[model samples]
Target chain A: MKLFSVEKPGLYTTYQDLGRVGYLKYGVPASGALDRFALQVGNILVGNERGAAGLEVTMQGPELLAEETFVMAVTGGDLSPMINGRRIPLWKSVLIKKGQVLEFGQPRQGVRAYLTVSGGFHAKKYMGSRSVYEPAGLGRKLEKGDELVGEPRQQKAGTGLFFTEIPDYDRDVDVRVVKGPHHEQISDKVVSDFFAMTHDVSPQSNRMGYRLQSDLATNHEANVISDGVPLGGIQLPGNGQPIILLADRQTTGGYTRIGTVIGPDLPLVAQLPPGGKIRFKEVSVEEAQEAAKQEEQKLRIWERFTR
Target chain B: MKITFYPLGEAAVKCCFHEDISTALTYNIQAFCKKLVHQKHVGISEWVPAYDSVAVYYDPWKLSYEEITNVLVPIANEMDAHEKKTKTVITIPTVYGSDYGPDLENLAAANKLSTKKVINLHTKRHYLINMIGFLPGFPYLSGLDERIAMPRLESPRQSVPAGSVGIAESQTGIYPLDSPGGWNIIGRTPLKLFDAEKEEPFLFEQGDYLQFTAISEDEYKQIQREIEKGTYKLERREESE
Candidate 1:
């Protein structure tokens, strides 16, 4: 069913899901929602599967015209979404009739937002995913006049997330990290200096990785033989700057990775806007796992209540 | 063949094979990956093989880091116990020199040899796919002849078309997609290295061998037509270890 038509394609809007799997060996990166937690919450609000394909809106949001009555929800980064000139609440499901126009204003919080429809966005799946990985020519950004479609799913009653469930994206975020494979290669003094410094998110940041700008300089030789790079791995190149690999990072890289951002803290890292300040804190692997367990538990609880 | 397990993060582990880069090491890693895949451990999502290590990614919620390490240790220890599998070599039909390879003349001039000599050197040896990375379906091939090896372009081309065969610093590779590259272009392949629509999206895999065969420009056009007609059959052969 035709759900909406793109009137104005906002800044870098693309369809995304949980991303492709089992193809990393072929040099494919797992391209998906940068903020996976927000996308899942949007899916839940609209009564769709957690991994449903949805629009990943950047700082700016697209202006869409509804083609039919459907339930939709916008979550993650407050880009100020509105329908028919009236503002809509984030993390809540709302129904829109045909001929209604949905648009967005200034981004008050967060760097990315997700717009999910009831049956999820019906985008072409490449290698079992609708995620748009532009470099590979898998999919391109949504453009003006593009018609958006969704599977015909029965509309459930509208719902909203509890106040406590909604994440606060407009705040100082301290991302936690675990020592990577080559963590021991660097000197202890350099490592301690790195943790003590605050970094600014470089403007060169994108889906591939976030390049951080810091004043700390080290003469450490950071180049290693190209090896497997994990998502959220913090790589230090020759310049002594750190690049945090993200959802679209290459399968292997030649730089030395100092540490990997814990899985639970990735969403917070993803939400950090350009020029945003970030601090890094080191934690043990066991502690990171415990945090992941708590996050999973919260999702499971939300899954039951949303169902 | 000692393999050490390290935590990449909560969701993945890096199995480091403390060995130098060699065809033997690649085969051993391939053998271990083959055995690991057969286990089909739940929550083990994906694994990538590199020059000297294999990174195993799994869902931490379903499987613990220790549980995955336990599953990987035995397989790494017994990897050599299994017999070596047959190797498959895929032939890539390429057109060397002329407009197809714009930098062929410049590369020949830099190496103090004719374009024909460079082409012969490139096609003589079977290159090994050490890994697939940098771009989707882009193979990091090894075994370039040192005689013709040259440095990458100081300023990379804004857009190197897909199927461009190039050489850089004792390494040769083909760009699977139209991407900005710095390698010295010497030839072009008509074959699509990656087609997302197909069941097997990538034509090459890590540990596989590739042989480039020179073809005339007319033959290239014919092969491309056959590919568009869905009638082109890739030339491949299986060699016993």
Candidate 2:
């Protein structure tokens, strides 16, 4: 059986799939990979279906020992990767020797990273996912002496291809959004300032949501009823700062929502790390849908390549 | 009439139980939610039950917003009749005061009442769990004796241990998980409020009746050990009107 054993985990790390759906009623947050784009790319490189469980490493990754599988590719968040004391290239598939020690160093760029094996790693699927939500203390994160078993694919099967560098890779990005239903409730200025201005990602950020510093000169807090909020919903609490909801955000909220991040640019927002600067550009629903269509087409084209 | 739908985007639809928040309306809305949850209507993924409003989320591809509201309004009307029907009173066994109640002295002093009198007043009123929020199974209860109504602690504690029984702004609840919270911790319950491992994670849900009993600290330790060992058998007493 092919597997990789964990050596050391750097910061916060977990085995995340796309997310846990159909369980929000139970108050369970859809815990999963923060950056779906990187996870999807990594899964595709390994010939596994997109949304497969992969190691979502924070800043740096853990040292692992491969049991049998040779080819593995890592994408998103540049980090120093070493294979058995020899430097290994990232954003491309590498030939890992049997019993080789693969270690990761500090991130050269971005906050989170993804590590994918030829076959996907195996963990207990909760509800319908294998993701580990630390807040609820579910599933497992890699630690020293821990083994990650995978459903190894045959070597002769998929092509062991590699890439030189990741495209569209960056630390921060300007997010595009569609206005919300409560958009009219808030001051015209809060909406204008949020759209026309730039904001910085606060250090107090996590998988649940990103706390963003507002560009508004003055502050106005409102006592809004807690209501349901979506993944990309931008909620400006009593404080002026806009807290952009993310993949693992609460199922509901009461704060005044500025807008949603739409579909296409969601990936770009996901790749951002704390302390990264980002701006918002408002777009109509039609524009958001068109962008989504383009992304869906891109996925379909890529699926035809190695299949 | 223009119904406010898609307020939170295509994910959810907002149906006002009433413009004003009322306990009676809360019951009516809760009844509506209970029926909806039972039906498991197509595309409706999760239904978050609250005091005066119910935020219903659905799969956009399954049904459009307008279509959902059509089905929601009619089904919600059934709640008015259902509320008048037979209602179940769920009594929750709570151990009040002592180490089980760490802030008992403080709570008593703040209310200018003896700890024994405070216990009697608290147990006398039948509480209604308006909703569950903040954390998993942290029930938001109403019906506190007006004599005991007090504001939350001036400074919210950074960490309140799990099973912490706290009161804040006329609401009482037990902390389901150990996390940073601002609730005025009056006491702690040895009973597990939430257990992800259990089939029913939340010990209490909306509309459940709560009656706290005074248990000694010695009994508190026994319950804690039982909870840890997974042998905590909670006693459910016969319902009394």
DockQ-based CAPRI category assigned to the predicted complex of candidate 1 = high
Interface RMSD of 1: 0.9
Give interface RMSD, every candidate, in order: 0.9, 3.0
Best candidate, DockQ: 1
Chain B, TM-score, each prediction?
0.96, 0.88
Model 1 Cα shift for residue A214 (angstroms)? 1.1
Provide the DockQ value for model 2: 0.28
Q: Look at candidate 1 and tell me the lDDT of residue B42.
A: 88
Candidate 2 segments exceeding 4 Å error: A80-95, A105-109, A126-128, A155-167, A284-307, B1-3, B7-18, B61-84, B221-241
TM-score of every candidate relative to the true structure:
0.98, 0.87
Pairs with backbone N, CA or C atoms under 3 Å apart (clashes), candidate 2: A226-A254, A227-A253
DockQ for all candidate structures vs. native: 0.81, 0.28
